[model samples]
Target chain A: MTGSKTTEYVTLVSNDGYEFKLLRSAACLAGTIKKALDPTSGFIETTQNRVDLPTINGVVLEKVCEYLYYNQKHAESRDVSDMDIPPELCLELLIAADYLDV
Target chain B: MSGRRPRGAGIRGPHSALTDFLAANNISAQEIRDSYQQRVRQAEQEAAQTDDNGEGPSNGGAEVEEDLQAESSTMAAERTRKRKRDQDEAIAKIKKGKAAKKVQKKKQKKNSSDDDSDFEDVMDMYKKAKPLPGQLENCELCNKRFTVTPYSKAGPEGGLLCTPCGKEMVKDTKAEAKANKPVVRRGRRKMESNRLDGMTDCGPKTLQQLCIEKLAQHSEDIDELGEMPEGIMNRISEIFSKKRAMNSTTMKLFLQPDMDRVAIHEAAYLETEDYDQIFAICPNVKRLSLRNCCQFKDSNIDYMNEKARALEEIQLLGANLVSNDKWAELFIARGKDLKAFKVEWLDAAFDDEAVEALTTFCPNLERLKLERCKQIGPDSIDAIARLQHLKHLTLRFHDPITREKLTHLIRSIGTNLETLCLEHFLDNTSDPTDDVLATIHTTCTRLSKFRFTENNECTDAGYVNLFSHWSNPPLRYIDINSTRDLDNTNPDGPQESPIGLASAGFLALMTHSGPSLEFLDISSCRHISHETFTLVFDGVKQYPHLVEINLSFCPVVDTHVVAGIFRSCPLVKKVVTFGCFRVEDVRVPQGIVLIGAPRAQDLIEQFGEGSLDL
Candidate 1:
């Protein structure tokens, strides 16, 4: 399943009830949100529709979703495709991605 | 050979039947295993008879494996009873005198202190005692029973012994002592000769080779000076220039220098002034494999810029290429004629931006391998998808690509994709689902090789869905081993097993007959089983193009089933059943090669003399 197409600003409710707003491309990186998108219903609901979708809680989901959004924005805004973010931040993302399975 | 038993022969037991059969004539292949089973049954019968008389161990099955041992146990019990009787008789004599002395002491002692006083008195009585000359004592040399004599008392150390016994002990140890003396000197000489022989085998070396060899020998001397002598460096330069002038690049100036020890030299070279000179010195060099070259930075790219036009391969597998991204990309783009590029960045981060640059810079790239690169995700995959000509792509331990992204990427250039290796690809957001499988099945038409070696996301159903389509029968190699989610239980409830691939993914492959498939290696995928094998091979007659199936390191296959599969798969070339314990004979289809059955090459390599030829 492809990630749910999001507007410029979108809301995500994590398993713990935390909310995150992010770009559609960034949200697509999470395989769970991708499966949540119901083409016929047009309302992307993560839980009941996709039984196989990994249930992400609010706290972790918020943080990981934030990372996806930030990384995507960073790519678009930077005129130089060769620019690199802080090495420490990259290590943090790797650890977070490993944990969330994103 | 004649098939008659010798006349008046006394067979030992039930096992004798098999022994007689073996002696009678050549045994048929079908009867060999059964005869062995019959021998086991005979041993069990003998054990049962021994148990009936209470002559064997309480556990009847204990002796079922050893008939001769069962008989020996009865005799051992009789001997043990006799030895106990002898030990009791000897104990009676030794206690008789001791008992009298103990009774007398007890009669004299009425108080608690009296016992201690009596014990002291008994010790005093023996203080000055000397043993009789003919009395037995333990020999100090060998600790054996011997008569005490002048020869037994060798100094104050008490060398009590029989003369003959002492001599025997000395004789026994003399050869051992001689053998213990070091033969290491001979070993060193042999090693030295071996080294000399290895050197001579190179044959007819020139003056340059001789010089290089001598330099290697004197590397320690050169290192002791803390630096190369100025005279030596100058001489090396002169030799290099002379060799270049003569178009003789064959002479390799060999000097063993530690990478850490050359840190100072590297620092000096890093000075901006020497950049041009560095390029001039290694102008023709194309491939560089660096190990902990901390001094080498992105700034060093300028030194190799001149050779970029002719550079086709740049392998900086592990280096600090990210420090100067502009120069790095410039190096990548400048090398328009590049064919292969393998670079590993220590930095873990990668997003669409950096990958976008890589994708744009190396558009003509055919093979791209990224390992532990954390920042890139499905978006980066899209960039790779943009590369229409790309053939081999390896993305290891990356975040999982969503079904949509995978679908898009596959649609972009999946037809040209020959091999896709995704190891441990995970997306924590969702567990594996059907969409992912559908995306792969619908797209990626020309995929001949797919290796999802380890993925935490994939489940049995996911694999079943992916493999069920099986329209792309051309896919020869698929490694989905080590996936824990697949349910490989046989309909009989895990009764029989095969390689680990016997799981749901294995059965999934069976749903679609692979007509042209070869090289199916499913090692250590424990879920593989005979149930899966029967499912696949039951319809093998229709798909006669199959060959080379590897089920090694899996515990499945009895001799009958193994032989049956060989006979069934008409085009089966090689079958590797290294771990199939029940198989003991190699059998195959009449014309096709059998490589993995009992006596087949693969099984032979694993079981017979540890060699390939059986």
Candidate 2:
């Protein structure tokens, strides 16, 4: 829980066993992931420094990760450009966005 | 009957203000013109005599020309010096309005001696001594001799400049002007909304608001807002509709095949076919609410009648394009299923017959609202009276109806009503003993929100009777603005019993309903004296539920009354005191807002919620 143990990055594992090692700040952009990995809450994921999201598949999770990084990059800005989204995976990505609360 | 022009008849257009001022001082316009003409003729005669006696002395015309040339040469040198000094003064004047006033006074003194100088300047303007085309002329800026051309531009001081130098000067002036201009950036609408919310901060939006705005910015890029809670979906829909992103493509994502209700808050962008699409998608929907549906047509309703048979409630606003016959047909077809029906801003078609048809068909209807619909009149008053199940009734009409018909309408349906809002019965003959208010007091027992506004007809006694020992539970909202005597001659109305909601009635209203009242607007109830205001909001008696109160145009309300309101109404969030100029020096608490006081701007603490920095 102290500052000494805090890592620069955290791991996110998808339902299909794909792991993404993302910057801690970027990963915390998603509200659900932030709450899960919050140090004060003492969640299991907080100690482990990894979140396993079983409901979201790797394809959707990868898009969410890309969006999290994109959001962090343009957090304190105006007139931000939209991230590219594929037409076919829109519904699935929306489900992932809802789960992540982004 | 003297043959003179009538007063005010001659005023057809704007007359010269200077001419008026001269006429007021007894200096005639005719005399001024005649004297000017005589002076010109005398000067011409003297010049003619000089020409005739040319042999006696030197040539008069040549000598006069020589003297003028010598004066102009001296004037040119003086002008250059004056121009530099004037430019410096102009720059200083631009920085302060006070400096400009001093400069203008100095200019007036100079203008009196330069009367003929102005005339000479005008003459020189028409007869420029600049070199003609094909003649060699010195470039004013570079001091280089060049052939004069028609395309040459005049330099700032006077003489013509070479083409390149002129272009460079023009560019330099434009760039300088652009650089000196102050850039203004404003989020004016955001500021207005924040003011309405009693927020003084000019800071950035909250994180949630920002995220919603960003999501709504690119809503088209989103395919589905996929499976969030109902409240979140509606909130997203609200943001989307406000941003006007609820067109055909985005609308489809909002409606699911299984959802029972489809409420689109802003349907201004939807096409006529989209109305049919509501049924096409959500066929089993029970309640349908579409506002600003300007394109709603008869065929859409027909499609809905066939598809959406289980439709129990419908609210459509600004759907004026639908014919009267379509309204009758819809009521006939699905009237039995309807429990609540609200239609507003329908000026073109929906008439008294529509009400007749609704009452005849819809026996189960409980909530009815018809606001700002033009065509319905006294004819439908009795027809609406037939509905036994009406509870929440709001009728803000723009038409003619005698007190008799209105009294009948209220008496028949008032027993079951919960919220009654009646507006603009202004034309009704004054009732010193208001039969309508009497009926409301006796019959409507369940009312929580009551509004009777813009009436010069009801006497104060009527309101007094209604609230004094009334059977109805305490009302939560009361808005009775513009309910006073409107005689222009008497600023103070009849003093014996007072008129409209005066002291007795207002006190009675507070006594009965102050406990449960959450919102109150007694604006423009001018007859209620300052003593009554202070007595009612006396700081010791607490009205626990009151949140917002408007005392606008109530001129007698002072700082003491405002402070007492803060003490008495602990939950009060906003207190509007516009035109209550006497309300200064009150210290508002941290979360409370005190708005519209003329001199309360600087007095607001930094932590105070209502600080409006002027």
Give the CAPRI rating of model 2: incorrect
**Against the correct fold, how does model 1 do in TM-score?**
0.39
Native contacts matched by each model: 0.00, 0.02
Candidate 1 per-residue C-alpha lDDT over B176-197 given as tens digits, one digit per residue, 9 for 90 to 100: 9969877534353443343333
Off by over 4 Å in 1: A1-102, B1-296, B320-327, B330-332, B348-352, B400-403, B459-473, B486-518, B534-614
What does DockQ come to for candidate 2? 0.04
The per-prediction i-RMS, to one decimal, reads 25.5, 6.6
**Residue-wise C-alpha lDDT for candidate 2, range B1-614, written one tens digit per residue:** 01122357865555599867854554545544544565456546757777687744347655665565566556544654675567555654454344344444465567758767566545644654566555556799998877678988889988898878878888899999979988544464543455566753233333334445566778888766667556657767788898899887888877888888888888999998888888998999998889999999989988988999889998999999899999999999887778889999999999999989998999888988888999999888788888899888888888867888888999999989998988886455444458889999988999999999988778888999999999999999999988998889997899987778999999999999999999999999999998888899988888999999999999999988988888888888888888988988776664666777876666633224443221
Best model number under lDDT? 2
TM-score of each: 0.39, 0.61
User: lDDT for each of the candidates?
Assistant: 0.51, 0.79
Give candidate 2 regions above 4 Å deviation. Answer: A1-102, B1-189, B197-208, B427-432, B601-614
Model 2, chain B only, scores a TM-score of 0.66
State how far residue B189 of model 1 sits from its true place (Å): 25
